[model samples]
Target: MTHAHAARPPRVAAGPAAREPAPGALPAWLAVLWAAALVATLAFAAVGGVHHAAVGVVTGAAFMALGAGMVVLLAPSDRVFVTRLFVGGFLARYVAALFITGAVMIAGLPGLEGGKDYLHWEASGWAVAEAWRSGSPTVHLTDKDPGYYYLVGAVFALTGRVAVAPLLLNGLFGAGAAVVAFFLALQVYDRRRAAVAGYLAAFLPTLLVWSGMVYKDVVLSFFVVACASAAIAISRQVSARSVCALGASLVPLFMIRPDTGVTIVGSAALLVGLTGRRRGSKLAALAVAGGVLLLFLAVLQGAGLGGKMDLLARFPNPLTSVAVARESWANEVGAGSSGLTRYLYGRNLLLAPHLLLAAMVLPFVLPLPGTTGGMMSIGTFLMPGQILWLLLLPGLLAGMAGAVRERAAAGIFLAGLVLAMALGVALAGYFSNPRYLVQGVPLMLVLSAAGIGYLRQRLLLYVSMLLCSVVVFCLYALARGS
Candidate 1:
């Protein structure tokens, strides 16, 4: 017999409240967050020894440009609040980039003592930009993901080699991600709850820090979330807008991170098939989804990964093969986090077999390792969200439970993306570096946001427990130091 589902709540009629939030909420939030980011950017420039007088000017101008784009993408939704979300989220990331720049350049950040990929990308990008400007031969990097460098070079060329310009572009994408989170949450939940999720997407530490960095974090995450969101919309209705959105999102996504792109597309294909209204519509939607996959595979082959893909297929178990590869790569991350990784994965095969179960629970436990900050590493910069993650874990669980009870497809779609990425990271034993987990942070924040409404009294209880945990951790750190 089919199980009973909880009755869904009554939908409210579209009104001014739904169309526009409290008049100045977004604007106020944007003003404060942008000011913070600007202050930090200038401080970082001065402290980090940048001689460019235009740094502050450039930062402000970029925020303005990003704000303009945000309005175009989100304000058109009849929700001026969404445009505000773009500002909050973009500035959060903007502040994050400057913090990282300062830490790496000034504080002798213990975390990234070994290597700083963003600095490398910035330097290389500047070189490429200069070559292009002077009519010199182009520089091509063969060792790494050259696509990101080329993008950085293009931005630097246009802006005359301004530092962190690519990061500003990434912040723009991060802002778009925030807007997408708002709309998706609104679709699945309600306007009020969606607004909460949207703002959470803006202020969450991991979301800000990773998106703020000049690396591939925000761009990679945006496409994945955008693809997943489009996939969910397709599940609701196979429309030209949703189909085109899915294709546009999944194409660049594949070029950026192939596995995550597959997870998103695969999830979409499954979702569309399961939820389509009719046999004809289901077939058509599935066909379009398959077309995107085929196009991505062709691109992969052109990029010289066809043989690797075929070899991956030849594996008796692809997950195991991928895991071994990731484990090897994780070793490169260094010895400090090796203990943490082993503690999570273990020598025994206990964690890997329970992929779905483990993926759902693993992200919460990540904050445990470096909470004391005794051994700083690259993970430390991303670790600002650790305690926040702890604080939100209960709500995340509560939100997931609520979604299950209500049978919310959007929640399932979001939960799917988050868990899929976590599972892949877990299987690969890539626990040492938390950046791999950034792909899921925005969606996790959405879940936590929804859970906030569900936790009426328990919220205070959770906060008290969090404070207790912090006190205990502090005591332990003091004891060790003494």
Candidate 2:
């Protein structure tokens, strides 16, 4: 019998292959970094003498509560197994916000300030608040963001005009931004990488310094990141809910910075056209976005939203103005720069290598001499502890390379967002400062985290290079300071 039929292969399971377990939550090293940042910032605040110290304390408590509430609402459901991460993130960000509020309050005190720009901001913000309280038009005061003024005014009214009020509000925004960056990176990559990105977003000097200030830069940064996160969600799974989230996020952006809002939409359109899987729907999305932008611009112009400095007038024809503005700024501030900064501020495209170098490095390493004006608003040092950012550069480059290779939709969005910012900065001379690029800092952190993940195999090499970069930056800073 016959047979010696070969024993049938053990019945193969008919179900899908067993999926790999997801990565663990934020790493212990990241927790260490966050704690260090908190201690350092608090020390700085204590030594700096927190102005309105009592107010800062009260505001910090409020922000801590806000941070805790946010964790409950926004912590990712998929990471239920690592639920302690929610607690860690909320605590880290909450403490960071408290210290930041104290520092900003101390630095932003009305009489002891250093920058006219900050003074202007404070006065304008107070006036806006008063006007809102008394029901008057702030249109004549300035052509800047109404949303910021409204918010600042509301906070001032609530807190009885304490300078800490705005600082506290901004602190909350910064903390919320860290949370958003965490989830956003989680969507793009895995948990460990997400932790890296979130840690950087939460503690990065760029965000901490800018977001702690009284300026609108941090608010713009938050909205930009929010819009990017919403866009990423939509890209992963397009739905009415995602679209509405995107639209809702953009509304505040439009109110605060219309040009940036346009740039975001334009970038989003490019992203969908390049990377969207659906052929027909992609085209339709592009058309609709374009139409909406054009209509919005027309409506803004019709409503005289731009006043004398009409944004629409500069559109579709900004190069000439850009050149003029670049020349003027170079004459004003491009004196000692030797590398990309000199060339870029000089608006010299013939030195494209310098442009590339500067574009890649300036966001992290751009130095401000101690004697430089506008120290109060910008800070005594541009990105203090600047050497640390070197750790992320390799990751950023590696991530960008991998993204291009993969033809990832997230990569397209990142490229578009960066390009739009670069172009916008070039086009608007007044907006040419590095601070204007703060909006994209969250994405930059995301890319850097991706870079870390990609280079995990070459861990030693990456660490060595990172250390060398930090050493070099320190040596350079010392030499310059000396």
Off by more than 4 A, model 1: 1-31, 48-53, 77-79, 108-110, 127-146, 279-358, 365-383, 457-482
lDDT, candidate 2, residue 25? 47
User: Whole-model lDDT, candidate 1?
Assistant: 0.64
Clash pairs (backbone) in predicted model 2: none
TM accuracy, model 2: 0.74
For every model shown, what is its TM-score relative to the native structure? 0.76, 0.74
lDDT of 2 by residue, 289-382 (tens): 6845753453343223443237666565445544555565465445543454465555565434434433554455545545344544343544
Candidate 1 lDDT tens digits, 1-482: 22333465567899546665466554555678768866886787687556432553475467657665757764575445665566667767767766666665655534552246656777777777888788886645412345566677888787765555677777777777777777777767787777887777777777776665667767776777677778777778879999998899877776656667666766666666656565367586775578466434433332234232363353355445445544554453323433544455445444344455446545654433344343444556545676677777777867877777888767776776677677666555554345677777778878878887788557676676566655644443342233
Candidate 2 Cα misplacement greater than 4 A, ranges: 1-51, 76-114, 280-282, 285-309, 314-319, 338-358, 369-383, 426-432, 459-482
